[model samples]
Each structure stands twice: as structure tokens, then as C-alpha cells.
Target chain A: MRITALAGGVGGARFLRGLRTHLDRSPGLADTELTIIGNTGDDISLFGLRVCPDLDTLLYTLGGGIHEGQGWGRADESHRLLGELAAYGAVPQWFTLGDLDFGTHVVRSQWLGQGLSLSEVTTRLARRWGLPDQRITLLPMSDSPVETHVVVEDEDGQRAIHFQEWWVRYQASIPAQRFQAVGMDRATAAPGVLDAIRGADVVLLPPSNPVVSIGIILGVPGVRDALRGTTAPVVGVSPLIGGMPVRGHADACLAAIGVESTAAAVAGLYEDFLDGWLVAPEDEASVRLPRATVRSRPLLMTDTDAAADIAGAALDLARELAA
Target chain B: MRITALAGGVGGARFLRGLRTHLDRSPGLADTELTIIGNTGDDISLFGLRVCPDLDTLLYTLGGGIHEGQGWGRADESHRLLGELAAYGAVPQWFTLGDLDFGTHVVRSQWLGQGLSLSEVTTRLARRWGLPDQRITLLPMSDSPVETHVVVEDEDGQRAIHFQEWWVRYQASIPAQRFQAVGMDRATAAPGVLDAIRGADVVLLPPSNPVVSIGIILGVPGVRDALRGTTAPVVGVSPLIGGMPVRGHADACLAAIGVESTAAAVAGLYEDFLDGWLVAPEDEASVRLPRATVRSRPLLMTDTDAAADIAGAALDLARELAA
Candidate 1:
């Protein structure tokens, strides 16, 4: 069986890691292959090196190199490189890149500068993380550069800044007027991305930001169409629990797009294709969909086992909908 | 007094540091401004980051951040970044880059990618190293991209590889057939390079590699013309001690250009513009120049004081020639 998922940065990575653990432990599903389509809208060029935050998080978290406490960067990482960069007064000091993490961006930039596509680069990076050995193939959503920019009003008076500045720098305190994927019109789905969605036995959406993470990926040409056309049961795990995001500024992101910060509203964003929805126990009663089956579960993701339980519940919901 | 010097990597940087020390201690020379024209032929793009080895060595040495034992790179540096790059199987694993050194390359690449001239980028980097505070101005030989490629024959047959690969990786052992500055045909002298030489009260050449270092700088259009036309006495400290380079592969580099490994032969290369020559005491009798005054000194830069003494001798020779 093949399971395809669309992921964002931290939350999505953590949930996918849990799902991998669950699959490995299960008897019949142990041989199931997982294909992860990572959102690259958050990609930014920092210090002249291309940085793919979401893809790197998935690589680290799934490969057992993630800083558990931070849920993103590498474990046992040092910041001496960053300290030197700061000494030089290089800009955008808000986003932290550890010395170990810098290795990823450097090589990615080098390969990309050499004319390799983002998919090829991500495949190489995944190999280094031993993802192929675990029957996991990680790919960027699109090979073309697609950066999400946020429009905000501040002392500077209405300007568009890179999504990272608004998210990592400002902590999203300033109200965002809207989010724009700067190159979405030109971005075609990466090789195997459409096939993964159209041919999967089951499709899962991890608890990534609905407004920015998964939404930006869905904006890719033919991606939404592929989802709606696929015969597989599409299951989504809500990023929000009890009307609040478990991590990141999903509420602010939703506000920018004029969507309510609730599991139902989040599910509505995927209503065209979503056949199964997994929500937190407290929010399950409020989520009612005409075309999708709704289920309730404790979704704190307090530990690997708790996260596995949540992921296992979502898979079970998908299986029920398929049956 | 205004002093100008042409420099390379380790040896030149150490000599200049010593010169700076000497100038600071000397009564009248304390107020003197030093302008250094650094060779860019050895520059390489490692991992897509612009690595200006000669300029960085000068920065670290003059700024008191150099590793005294190694004569180059940052003191108290970590190799975590390189270690990670190696793990990713990035090529050219021979030339090591410490984490701190990577900071320099990262920012330089970033600025250069943003369309800043190499001279402007070097200025910003020099500012961080407090070169302005020391009243020291460092300029690259050419703002245009100029890389020295060496033609060598081994298992790969006759092909041109980057100068750094020949110097650092192979230790200059392959017996270079010839040295070619790849972009020198289209290259023009960087702003202030020619002016620094023409306007200097004294022009000194440190114990840098005569062929690859100083020789490459002279290849820039109008630089040698500036030296030939300048009124300032051009004095040079020999890199050789008893027909042998104190450090690096100066002999190999000289041999590549069909020149002998002798102070006399080196002085002959600059006979048209050289007004003063300081050689090792052992070579004083043999080094006979028709126009340039030949002098002898203990040229081994064993320590700061030794280097300073040699630099002072070169200045005294320049002053005597002027008188």
C-alpha cells in the first residue's frame, strides 16, 4: 500500500514521524511506502543559500535527527556560524540556522546553482537522511521557486514582506492583510507529485497550517484538480485543537484569509476532496460535513505514542471511508 | 608616508601584520596609511560561496583573529560546518573551511549575489575586521572575476583545474605545465589599485609567492603600467631563502613559468619596475640587478619581530633608493 501526505514544517513533520512509527510497528502495514509532498512556499534565500524550512524539518524529524525540544532544526547543533554572520551584521537575524543545519542550505544552493531541480536536490538530501531505506520518498511540491509573501500594514504603511519575516521575525503579531504565493502561477507540480496523489491507496493531510502550508501547496497548478479527481479517500488531521492551533500562528494565518480559527472551517478548506476528517475530541461536535465523515480523538500529540495514536486514528478513518 | 603593497595568502598576510606592527612602533611611520592590493587569482567558489582566501587571510591576520600556529584562518574555530558538508558528500574535501571562515564566504556570496562588486564586498568585509580603524585599505587586483587555472597532467590527462586545487589540495606536486589567469583577458584593475601604486610614497612587495601571488596581480591590465610609470621606489622582499621558499610552493610556481628558483631570477621578472631588492644574506652576492639596488637580510619570518625586522629592512632600502 502507498500512503501520500502533504506536509508543512514542524507540526506536519512531527505527525508524519508518528505515522512512520505506527506503520513500522503494525503487522500488515509494515511494508507500506510513504510519499511525502512537502510545501516549498516557505522557501527563502538567506545568506545567498536557499533554505527550505518545511522539507528540512520533515527530513530531520523523520530521520531521527530533529531537535525534539524545538521540533525543527537538527539535534546537538551549534550556532558558531550564525554568531560569525551576526558579527558581520548580515540581515534577517530572526530566523535561526545552526551550523549543522547550514550544511543543508549550502549543498542545496550549490546543487541548485548547478541547475538541479528542487525535487532532485530534496531526493539527494533525503538519501543522506536514510529516508529511502525506510521506504519514504520526500519531494518538494514544485521544482520552480514559490515563495509566500505576506502583506501587512505597519509603521512602514502597507508593504509585502517574505513569509518568514512575518512568521519567524514578527511572530505574526502584526495583522496580515493577506498571504500571496509569489510564483504560484508559474509553478508546476514536481515530478511524481501528481502521480502520488492520483495513485495513492490513501491520501493524508498532516496537521500543517491550513491557510499557508497545505493551502499554498494546493494552489500549485493541477494539484487541487488531482486531489478532486483521485479515487482514494482523502483524510485530513486538523491543525487546530479546541479552536486553537497546537503550534505555529495558524490563527493569524486563517485571519488573513478571512477563515474562522476552527476545525470545521479548516476542514471546509478541503471540502471538495476530503472524505474523512479527524478532529480533537472537544471540537468534534462542532465539525459536521455533508460529504465527509467526522471522527473525534485526543489530539495533543504529547509524545510519540500519543502522536502515533492520533495518526493511527486518522488512518482508521480513511480505511472506514474507503470501505 | 603612504605605503602600498601587493599580497597573497599566508606569507603575505603575516608579513603585512608584521609591517603594521612596525609602522605602529616607528616614530614618523606611525601616522602612515597602508594600502594593500591583494591577488584574486586564488579565489574559488566552494559550495557556491565565494571564498576569497587571500583577502580573508589578510583580514584575519591584521585583525588579530588569525590562528598563529597555522598562519591562516580564524582562531578558536570549529569544523562542524565542514564536517556536515563532508557528510553530505560535497566535493573537493581537501580544502578545509572552519565554521567561522564559512561566515565570511556566506556573506560575501550573499552580497555578490545581490550584484555588489567584489571590491565593494571586500570593503564591507574589511570594515568588519576593523581595517578602517587601523587606517588600512585592502583592494583586490581586479573587480572583474579572475581565477588562476593550472594546466596539469596526471590520471585525468592534460586539463586545467582551479589554482586552489593545485596549491592547497595537491600541494603543488603535480608539476604544473603553466599557469593561466582564466578571466584576466577581460579583467581591468579594480578601482584604487592603480592609484594606490602610482600615489604611494613607497611600494613594497612582501614575501608572497612571486609567480602565482604577485605575478597574477601584475597580470591585471594597467597594474604593471602603473608600477612602471609611478615615481615611488618599488622595493620587494624575496620569498626565497638560499634558493628555497620559506613556506608554500613558490619554487614550483616559478618553475611553471620557466623561471629558476633564485632571488636573482625573481628580481629579473620585475627588473623594469623594481628599484630595490631585499634577498637572504646567502643570495646577496649572486642577485645582481642592473637598475635595482640589491640588499640582503635574514628573511625567515619565524615570529612577529623577525617579520617586522625584514619589513623594516625593505622600507630602509626603499628610502635609500629614493635618496
Candidate 2:
């Protein structure tokens, strides 16, 4: 079975960890091929080097080099590079770029400078992590530069900052007016992104940020149409469990888009394409989406085992909806 | 006093340390302005970053960040970036790029990509090290790219490899046919280079690699003529002592150029423009240059004190010649 998924950073990577564990243990599912369509909305260029945060999270997490404690970056990373950059008063010092992590960005930036597309560069990086040999393919939503910016009202006036600044630096302390994925209008889905959705046995949407993660992927031209038109069942796990995000600044981003931080509200945004929706048992009462199979389960991914159980629930829901 | 110096990497940096120490301790030389014309032939672009080995050596050494034992790079440097880079199978893993050093390259490469001349970029970097505030200026031999390539016979037939590959990786084991500083003919002296020589109270050549280091500096257009015509005496300290190079691959490089590794042979290369020469006391008997004021001293720069003593001797010789 080929499972196509969309992801962002930490939250999505953790959920996928569950799915990977589930796929490994499930009988007759040993041949499962995983295809991840990662969010490129968080991509930014610092000091002329292109940094793809979401793709790197997936690479580090799935490849087993991730800092298990922080849920992102290399395990043995050092911030010497970032510290040195800050000493020079280089801009945007808030976004933490570790020395070990900088190596990947350096290589990717060099390859991209030589005319390779984001997809090609991501593949090369993934290959370094032995992901391709594991039969897991990770692709960016689009080759085009699609950076998510957060519009916030500051002391001076309203201004837009890169999503990372709002998310990582400020901890989303200031109220966000809106979220914009710049350049999304012209970005076509990268090669194999549409195909993965169109031909997959199941399309799973991990619990990545909806306003900027999966939302940016769906904003790509022809992607929403492909998701709605695909023969495969589309299932999603709510990023929010009990009226709060399991991790990250998803709730703040959701509030900016005027969406209630509830599993039901989160699923309602995907009602047009979702064939199945998984919510926490406690939040099941609030969700009432039609056409999609509404299932409730223990959604807190406290461990890989818990994540596998949640992954199993999502996959079973998809199988039932298809039946 | 205004002193202009020509230099390379390790040896030059050590000599400059001594020179700086000497100026600091001398009663009337407290306000001495030092200008260094550093060799650019060893500069190479790695992973799209412009790595300037000599300039960085000067910066780290003089600015008090140099690795004391190695005479290059930052102290307390971490190799995490290089280790990660190697894991990705990035080529030329033989070259060690510490995390701290990579930061300088990133800033420089970005500045260069933004159309800043290398001299301007070097100034910016030196300012980060507070070099300008110290009344010391470091200029590249030329603003233009002039990488030294060592031509050698190999199993794949005769081919040119970067000087770093020959020096660092092969340890200059392969017999070099010739050292070619590609693009040397067109490279103009960087701004302030000619003026530094013309306005110099004294022009001093440190014990750098005479062939690839000081030799390439003179190869720049009008530099040798400036040295010959300048009213200030041109004095050189031999890198060789007791018929052997004090440090580095100078012996192999000289051998490749058909020059014997002797203080006398090395002085002959500088005879046309040299006004004074310093050889070790042991090798003074073998020297035969007639026009220059020949002197003997303890030439090995074993420590900053030794370097300062050597610097004093070179300055004294230049003063004697001027008298």
C-alpha cells in the first residue's frame, strides 16, 4: 500500500513517527510505501542559504538523527554557527540554526545555487539520511518559493514578519491579524505531489498546522481538486485534542484565520475533501461533519506506541470509509 | 611608524603576532600603523563559500581568536559542521572546516554574492574582529581570484589539483611539476596595496612561503616595480633557517620551482628589489647577495617573543640600509 501524507514540522513529524511504527508492525503492511508532501511555506533564506525547516524535520525525525527531546534538529547539534552569526549582528538571530543542522542547509543551498529544484535538493538530502532506501519519499508542496508570513499589529503599526519570527521568536505573543502564504497563487504542485495524492491507496493528513502547513499544500494549484477528485479516501487527525494544539503554535495560527481551536472546527475546514476524521474521545461530541466517517480515539501521541495506535485508528477509518 | 608587510598563512600570522607584540612594547612605536598584503593564491570556494585561508589566519591570530597550537582558525572550535558535511558525502573531507570558520565564509560569500569586492568584504570581516579599530589594515594580494593549482603526474596522467589538495590531503607527497596561480596575470593589486608600499616608512616581508605566498604578491601587476622604485627599503626575513623551511610546504614548493631550499637561494629570488636580508646566524656564511644589507639573526619564530625579536632584526636591517 502507498500512503501519501502532508506534513509541517514537529507535530506532523511526531504523528508520522507513530504511522511509521504502525506500518512496521502491522501484518501484511510491511511493503507500505510512504510519500510525504512537506510544507514549504516555512522556507526562508538566511544569509543567502535556503532553509527548509519542515523538510529537515521530516528528514531528521524519520532518519533517526532528530533531537528526541526537542522534536526537531540534529541530536548532537551545536549553536556555534548561529552564535557567531549573531556576534556579527547578522539579522534574524531569533531563528535557531544549529551547526550540525547548518551543514544540511549549506549543502542544499549549494545544490540549489547550481540550479537544482527544491525537490531535487530534498531528495539528495533525504538520500544522505538513507530515506530513499527505506522507500520513503519526501517532496516539497511546490518548487516555487512559498513563504508564510504573519501580519501582526506592533507599536509602530501593522507589519508582516516571517512565520518563524512569529512562531519561534515571539512565541506568537502578539495577536496575529492574518496569515499569508506569499507566492502561493502561481505555485503549481511539484512533480509527483499530485500523483501521490491521485494514486495513493490512502491520503493521510498529519496533525501539522492547518493555517500554514497543510493549508499551504492545499493552496497549490490543482492540489485541492486532486484531493477532492482522487479515488483514495482522505483522512485527517485533528492537531487539537482538547481545545488546544498537541504541540506548536497551531492554535494561534488557527485563531488568526478565525477558526475555533476545536477538533470539530478543524475538521469542518477539511469537510470538502475529508472522507474520515479522527478526534479525541472527549471532543467527539462536538464534531458533526457530514459525509465523513467521524471516529473518536485516544489522540494524545504520548509515545510511539500511542502514536501507532492513533495511526492504526486513522488507517482503519479510511478502510471502513472505502468499504 | 608606518610599516607594510607581505604575508601568507601560518608563518606570516606568527610573524605578525611578534610584530604586533614588538610595536606594543616599543617606547616610540606605540602608534605604528601596520598594513598586511595577504596572499590570495590559497583561497578556494568550498560548498559555494569563499574560504580565504591566509586572511582568516591573520584575523584570528592578531585578533586573539587563533587556535594557539595550529596557528590558524578559532580557539575552542568545533568540527561538528565538517563531520556532518562528511556524513553527507560532501567531497574533499580532508579539509577541516570548523563551525566558527564556516560562519566567516558564509558572511563573506553572501557579501561577495551581493557584489562587494573582496577587499571591502575583508575590511568588514576585520572590523568584526575589531582590526580597523586597532589601526591595522589587512588587504588581499589582489581583489581578483588567483587560486594556486599544483600540476602533478598521476595515474590519470598529468592534471592540476588545487594547492590545498596537494598541501593538505596529499601532504605534497606527489611530485609537483609546477605551481600555477591561475588568473594571476589579470589580477590587479587591491586598493590600498600600492599606496601601502609607496607610503611605507619600511616594507617588510615576513617569513611566509616565498614561492606561493610572497612570490604571488609580487606577481600582481606593478607590485614588483613598486617595490623596486619605493624610497623605503625593502627588507625580507628568510623563511628558511639552516637550509630548511621553518614550517609549511615551502621546501617542496621551492623544489618544484627548481630553487634549492637555502637562505641564499631564497634571497636570490628577491635580489632584484631587496634592500636588506636576514638569515639565521648559522646560514649567514652561505648568503652572497651584494646590494642588500646582509644580517644574521635567530630566525625561528618559536614564540611571540622569538617572532618579536625577528621582527626587530628585520626592521633594524631596513633602517641600516636606509642609512
Candidate 3:
């Protein structure tokens, strides 16, 4: 079986990791080829080094190197590099990059500077994480630099800042007027991105931020079209639980797009192609859809086993729809 | 009073740091402005980030962050970043950069990418190291990217490799045919480099590598002329003791250029402009010069205090020459 999933940072990475765990334990499913299309809209250049937050998160989480407590970055991390950068008074001190994590950015920047596309650089990075050995192929949504910029109004007046500045620095407290994928128009889907979706047995959207993660991937020129055109059943696990995000600022993100913070509203965003929707038990009654089957399950993903069960439920729903 | 010095990496940084210490304790000399023109030919792009071995050595030493045991790099440094890079199979893993040291390259690369000249970047780095507060100005020999490439014949056949690969990786064991300053033809002296040389009350040469360090600096346009035209007496501390260097592969570097590893031979390279030459007592007998004063002293910088005394002796010689 082939599974293609669109993922963001922590939440998406966690869900996909759980999906991998589920596949590994299930008989006959161990050979499944999983192609993850990671959101690159969160990509930022810090200290002239390219940082792909979502892709790195997936790499770390899946490779067993993740800071489990924080749910992103590397385990056994040190901040000495960051401490030195701070002492030098280099700007944007808010987004903390560990010494180990810096290794990724430095090599990625080096490879990219050497004229390799993001896909090529990411492939090299993934190889280091043993992603290929696990039958995982993680590709950025697009090779073109697509950064999500958040438009926010504050005492300083209206301004557009990189999504990370708003998300990591300001904690998204600053009301975002809207989100902008700065280079989406020029971005073409990374090689295999469209094919992964079009050729997959099942397509899953993890519990990633709707506005900046999956939504940003959807904005990639041919991505949404592929989803609508693909014959595979498209399943989505709701990022929200009882009108609030399980993680991150999905509610605030939905508000910026004028969408209600509800499972039904999120499903509505993908109504054209969505085949099945997985929601929290509390949100089951309110998330009814005419074209898609809505299923209720405990979506908290409190642990890896819980996450595996949730992911398995989503896959089951997709399989039922396909049948 | 204005004092300028030419420098390389470890030896130069140690001597200059000692010079600063000596100046601080000497009455009336405490206020003297010291300008250091550091060699940049040793600069290399590692992992696609600018790595200035000599300049960083100067900064870390003068800033009180140097690894005392190694006489270069940051104290209490961790190799976590380098470890990660190695895991990713990034090339040129021979020259290791510590986590704390990476902070310097990252910011410098970022600033350079933003179109800041190397001199400007060095100034900012110096500020963080409190060089400005100590009235110390560290200038790269030239703003242009001049790299020293060593031509060596090995089992791989004759090829020109980066100076660092020869020096650090091979430990200069591979006999060098000759040394080439790859971009020196188009290199101009960085701003203030010529001024520092010509306008100083005293000019001193630290016991750095003669062929690769001080020699490369002299290759910059107008620098040799400025040294010759300067009203200030030019004094040099011999890098060799009894025809042998105390540290580093200076003899091998000298051999590459067909120059004998002797104090007198080294002074001959500066014969046109040298005013005073400081050599070890054993080498004093052989280093007689017609135009330049020869002074004998213990050339070994065994510790900080010894380095200070040696630097102070060089200054005294310059003062005597001026008088």
C-alpha cells in the first residue's frame, strides 16, 4: 500500500510518526511506502541558513531523535551555539535553534547554496535521518522558497512578519489579519509531490494547522487540483477538538481566514476532495458533511499508542470510503 | 601613540593578546591605539560558510574566549555542530569548528550575504569581543577573498588543494611544491589597512608563519609600499628559534617557498623595509643586517607573560630605532 500525507511541524510530525508506528505493527502493512509532502511555507532563513521547520520536525520525530517533551527539535540538544549568537547580538533571538539542530540548517544551506534544489537538499538530509530505510520519502510541498508571512496589527501598526515571528516569537497573540504564502504563485509542486497524491492508495491530512500548514500546501499551484482529481480516498484528521486546536493556534488561524473554528468548517475547506473526516467525539454531531463520511474518535493523541490508534482509525475510514 | 601589527592565526593572536596585556600595564602606553592587520589568505569556505581561521583566532584570543590549551578557538567549546555536519556527510570534515565558534561563522556569513564587506563584518565581530573598548582595531589584510592554495604531489597526483586541507588535514606532511595566493592578483588592501601600516608610530610583525601569513598580507597592493614608506620604524619578531619554529608548520611553509627556516633568511624577505629584527639569542649571530638593527631575546612565547615581554622587547627595539 502507498500512503501520502501532508504535514506541518509538531502536530503533523507527531501524527505521521504515529501512522508509521501503526503501519509497522500491522501485519502485511509493514511494507507500506509512505510519502510525506511536508509544508515548506514555514521555511525561514536564520543567520543566512535555510531552516525548514516542518520538514525537520518530521525528520527528527520519525528518526527517533526528537525532543519528545517539546515535540520538535532534537533530543540531548544544547544551546551553546545560540548563546554565542546571542552574545554577538544577532537578531531574532526568539526562535531557539539547538546546537544539534543547527547542523541541519548549516548543511541544508550549504547544499542549497551549492545550487541543489530544496528537494535534493532535503533528500540528502532525509538520508542522514534514515528516512529512506524506513520506506519514508519526505519532500517539501514545493522546491521554490514559499514562506508564510502573517499580517498583524499592533501598537507598532500593521505589518507583515514571517509566520515564525508571529508563531514562535509572539506566540500568535498578535491578531493575524491574514496569512500570505509569499512565493506560492511562483512555486511549482516539488517533483513526486503531485504523483504521490495522485498515485497513493490513501491520502491523509494530519492534525496540522489548517491555515498555515495544509492550507499552504493546498495553495501550491497543482496540489489541490491533484487531490480533487486523484481516485484515492482523501482522509483528514481534525486539528481541532471542541472548537479549539489540540496544539498550536489553529483557532486563531481559522479566524483570520473567516472560517469558524469547527471540524465541519475545516472539512468545508476541503469539501471538494475530502472523502472522510475524523473528529473528536465531542465534535462528531456538529461535523456532518453531505459528500464526506464523518467519524468520531478521541483525537487528543496523548501518546504514541493513542496517536497510532487515531491514525489507524483515519486509515480505516479512508479504506471504508474506498471500498 | 599608534602601534600596528601584522598577524596570522595562533601565534599572532597569542602575541597580540600578550601585547594588549603589556600595553595595559605600561604607564602612558595604556592609552596607545593598537591596530592589527590579520592575514585572510587562510580563509576558507567550509560547509558553505566563511571560516576565517586567523581573524577568529585574533577575536577569540583578544576577547578572552580562546581555548588556552590549543591557543586558538573558543574556550569550553563543544563539537556538537561539527558532529551533526559529519553525520550528514558534509565535506571537508578535517578542520573542526566548535559550536561556539560556529556562531561567528553563521553571523559573519549572514552579514556578508547581506553585502557587508569582510572588514565591516570583522569590525562587528571585534565589537562583540570588546576590541573597540580596548582601543584595538582588527583589520583583515584585504577585503577581497584571497585563499592560499598549496600545490602538492601525492598518490592522487599533482593538484592544488585549499591551504587548510594541506595544513590541517595533511598536517603539512604532504610536501608542498609551492604556495599560490589564488586571488591575490585582484586583491586590494582593505580600507584602513594601508593607513594602519603607514600612519603608525611603530609597526611590529608577530611571530606568525612567514610564507603563508605575513607574506600573503604583503602581497596586497600598496601594503608593501606602505611599510616601506612609513615614517615609523618597522620591527619584526622572528618566528623561528635557532632555525626552528616554536609552534605550527612555519618551516614547512617556508620550505614551500624555497626559503630557509632561519631568522636571517626570513628578515631577508623584508630587507627592503625592515628597520629592526628580533631573533632568538642563538640566531642573533647569523641575522646581522646592514640596514636593520638586530636584537636578540628569548623568542619562545611559552606563556602569556613571556609573550608580553617579547612583544614589549619588539616595541623597545622600534623605539630605539626611531630615536
Candidate 4:
């Protein structure tokens, strides 16, 4: 079976890690291909280099080079560069660029300046990291620049800030009015992005932020339309469990969009295209999902083995819907 | 009094350290304005980021932040970035970029891309380093890119190689034919370069590589002419003492240029413009200067104090000529 997964950052990376593990162990799932369409809204220009945080997370996680503890960047990282940049009074100083990770951005920036598309540049970077051929194909949502900004009201009144500054710098301390994906109105889906969804036997949306992660992908022209028209079953795993985010500030983002931080609310956002929904057993009693067949299970992926179990359960649900 | 100094890498840096120390203590030299025109012939672009060896040497040395033992870069530099870049098979693996130093290059490369001249960029970078307010001005020979290449005869016949590859990569093991400043024919001196010479009370050349370092500076259009016409006395300290170069591949470059490595031979190269020459006592017997007055002294600056003594002696010679 050819499976296409729509993913964001940490949560999506964890789910993909589990899915890969399950596929590797299943004897009957031979010749299965995984294509991951990653969100690029969190991309930023840092220290005069282009840094795609979400894409790097996915690449490092799948290529077996991610930091096991932080769940992002490269393992065995150093902060010598970060310290120097700080000394120079670089703005938006909260996010750390580990020494090992800066090399990736350096190469990407150089290649991008040389007239290569983000997708082509990503392929070259993945090849350098020793990613397996045909096992996983990573694609960015668009080649053009798209940034996620947060409009917030603090003691100084209302203003818009880059997603990184709002998320990493402020630690989501202020009240957010709304989340905006700047430049998405005119943005076209990257080459092969729509085709990946159209050709897949099943589509999986991992447990990533609904408003900024998956919602940003849906905001691109014709992407949500593509999902609605696809014949394959589209499944979404809830990022929220027990009224809180699994990790990071997903609740803050949900609040920005005026949506309650509940599995039911998240499911409603994707109900038009989703055919199956997976939620935690705790939230199964109160959740009201439309049209989509809802399934309750242990949604937490505490380890690689546990994550594979969750991925296997999601795949089984998709298979039952197809039958 | 205005003082002009010509410098190269580590050895010249050490001499300037002494020169600064001496000037700080001298009663009459408290208001002396020092102008250091660093050699840019050793500059190269690695992975699309400019790496300026000589200018960085001067910056770190005068800024009091250079590694004491290594004589270049930050004191607590780390190479995590270079190791990662190597894993990606980046070419020209000889020169390493410390993580801290990489930030400097990224800023410089960004400014250069935005149409800033090298002189303007250097001024900005110096300000970030917390340099004294106009205590010293560092200028590149020209804002235009000019690289010194070494013509070497290997088993594959003669080929012109970049100066860094010749010195750092090959360690100057092969026989070289000539040293050529590739873009000097059409290059103009950077703004303020000619004015610095004309306004100076004395011009002193430190013991830098005569062929590649000081030679490339003179190769720029109007620079040599300015030196010849300046009312200020121009004096040069020998990079060679007792028929041998003090440090680096100066001897190899001298061989390539068909000049025997000796104090008198180096003096002959500067005879048309220079008014005085400083040599070590050991080479006093062989010294034969035509236009410049020659003086023999203990020319080796073993420490900061020793470097100041050498600078004092050079200034005394200039003052005597003025009297």
C-alpha cells in the first residue's frame, strides 16, 4: 500500500517514527511506500540563513540523526555558535541553533541562493543525511515563502509577531487574537504535493497542531479541495488528549483560532475530508465527530514500540472503512 | 601623529600587539591615530561564505579576543560545524571554521550580498566587536575581490592554485613557479586607502609576506603611486632575518617570485617608494639598500614588550628624517 502522511513538527515526527517501525516489522506490508508532506509555515530566516524547523525535525527523526532527548535537531549538538550570535546582540534570541544543526541551514541557504527550489534542496539535504531511497519521500507544502504569524494583545496593546518569536521567545505568555499564515492566499502547492495525496491508498494526518500545522497545509489553494475529492480514506489522529496538548503550545494556538482545546473540536475542523478519527479513551464519551467513524484507543506514544501500536491501530481503522 | 602599518597573519599580529603596548606607554604618542591596512590576498570563499584570514587575524589580535596559543580565531572556539560539514562531503576540507567564527562570516556574507563594500562591512563588524572608537581603522587593499594564486608544477604539470590551497592544504610542499594577484590589473584601492597614506606622518611595514601579502597591496592601481608620492617616510621591517622567513610560506612565495629570501633582497623590492629599512643585526653584512636609509636592530618581537620596542625604533627613524 502507498501511504501519504501530512505532518508538522515534533508530534508528526513521533507518529512517523512509529509508522516506519510498524512497516519494517510487517511481513505482509512489503513494497509499501510512505510519502510525507511537511508544513513549512514555521520556516524563518535566522542568522542570515534559511532554517526550516519542521522539515529539519522530520528529516532528522526519519534519518536516525535526531536528538533523542529534545526530539529535534541533531544529537551531540554544541552551542558555540549560539553564544557568539548572542554576543553580537542578534534579535529574536530565544531559539537555539545547535552547532551541528547550523551546517544544515548553511548548506540549504547556499543552495537556495543558487536558484534551487526548496523541494530539490531538501532532497539533496536528505541524501547527504543518508536517508533510504523509496522508503520515505519528504516534500514541503510550497516552494514560495510562507510564514505563520500570531496576532496578540499584551500590555502594550495589539501587534503581530513571527510565530517563532510568539512561540519560542515569549513562551506563549500573552493572549493571542488569531493565527495567520502570511502569503498563503496566493501560494500554490509544491510540485508533486497534490499528486502524492491523489495517488495514495490511504492518507494519515499525524497528531500535530490543528490550527497552524495541518490548518496551514489546508489553507494552500486546492490542497483541501484535493483531499475532499480523493477516493482514499483520510484519517486524523487527535493532537489533544484530556483537554491539553501532548507537547508544546497547541492549546495556545487552538485558543488563537477561538476553538476549544478538545478532541471533538479538532475533529470538527477536519470532518469535511476525514473518514476516520482516532481519539484517546478519556475523551471518547464527550466527543461528537461528524460523518467520520470515531475510534477510541490509547493515543499516547510513550516510546517507539507504543507509537508503532498506535500507527498500526490507525491503519487497521482505515482498512475497515475501505472494506 | 598618524601611523600606518602593513600587516599579515599571526606574526604581524604579535608585532601589532607590541606596537599598541608601546604606543599606550609613550608620552608623546597618546593621540597617535593608527591605520592598519590588512592583506586580503589570502581571502577565499568556502561553501559560499567569505573567509578572510588576514583581516580576522588583525581583528582578533587588536580586539583582545584572539586565541593566545593558536594565534587566530576565538579563544574557546569549537569545530562541531566543520565536522558536520565534512560529513556532508563539502569540498576544500583543509581550512576549518570554528562555530563562533562561522557566525562572523555569515553576517559578512549577508552584508556583502546586500551591496555593502568590504570596507563598510569591516567597519560594521569591528563595531560589533566593541572596538575602540576610531582608535584604529582597518582597511582591505580594495573593495573589489582580488585573490593571490600560486602557480605550481606538480606531476600533472603547472596549475595555478588558490593561495590558501597552496599554503594551508598542500603545506607548500610542491615547487611553485610564480605568485600572481589574479584581479589586480583592474582593481582600484578601497576608499580612504590613498588618503590614509597621504595623511600619515610615518608608514611602517611589519614583517609580513613580501610577495603575497604586501606585494598584492602594492599591485592595486594607485596604491604604489600614492606610497611613492607621500611626504611621509615609508619604512619596512624585514619578514626575512639571516636569509630565512620568520614564519609561514614566505620563503616559498619568494622562491616562486624569483627573489632570494633575504633582508636586502626584500628591501630592493620596496626601494623605489621606501625611505628607510629596518633589518636584524645578523643580516647587517649583506644589507645593500639603494634609496632607503638602512638600520640594523634586534628585529624579532618575541613578546608584546619586544614588539613595542621595534615599533618605537621605527618611529624614531621616521622622526629623525622629519627633523
Clashes of each: 0, 0, 0, 0
The docking quality of candidate 2, as DockQ, is: 0.73
- How close to the true structure is residue A93 of candidate 1, measured as C-alpha lDDT? 83
Q: What is the C-alpha DockQ of each candidate?
A: 0.88, 0.73, 0.92, 0.63
Compared with the true structure, what per-residue lDDT tens digits does model 2 show for residues B1-323?
89999999999989988988888888988689999999999999898789999999999998888999988889999899888878887777888899999999998998898899999999988988888777789999899999999999988899999999999999999989998999987899999999999999999999999998999898999889889888899999999988888678889989999999999989899888898899999999999887787899888888899999999888888878778
RMSD of each: 1.3, 1.5, 1.0, 2.1
Stronger candidate by TM-score (2 vs 4): 2
Which candidate achieves the best DockQ against the true structure?
3
Model 3, A1-323: lDDT tens per residue? 99999999999988988999999999999999999999999999998999999999999999999999999899999999888889989988999999999999999999999999999999998999999999999999999999999999999999999999999999999999999999988999999999999999999999999889999999999999999999999999999999999779999999999999999999999999999999999999898899999999899988999999999999999999989
DockQ of model 3, rounded to 2 decimals: 0.92
What is each model's TM-score for chain A?
0.99, 0.98, 0.99, 0.97
- Order of quality (lDDT): 3, 1, 2, 4
Please give, for residues B1-323, the per-residue lDDT of candidate 4 as tens digits.
88887778887777777777778899977778888888888999887788888988888888877888777887878888888788776676789788888877877887787789999888877777655563778888889899989899878998999999988899888888988888877788888898998889999898888888888888888888889999999988888889888678788888888888888999888988988888999998899776788898998877778888998888788877777
How well does model 4 score by local distance difference test? 0.86
- Candidate that scores best on TM-score: 3
After TM-score superposition, the amount by which residue A252's alpha carbon in candidate 4 deviates from its true location, in angstroms, is: 2.1
**Residue B70 error for model 2, in Å?**
2.0
* Candidate 3, B1-323: lDDT as tens digits: 99999999999998998899899999999999999999999999999899999999999999999999998888998899999999999977889899999999999999999999999999999999999999999999989999999999989999999999999999999999999999999999999999998899999999999999999999999999999999999999999999998988999988888899999999999999999999999998898798899999998888899999999999999999999
TM-scores of the candidates are: 0.98, 0.97, 0.99, 0.95
Candidate 3, pairs of clashing residues: none
* Candidate 1 wrong stretches, greater than 4 Å: none
Give the TM-score comparing model 1 with the true structure, all chains together.
0.98
- lDDT per residue (tens digit) for residues B98-155 in model 1: 9999999999999999999999999999999999999899999998989999999888
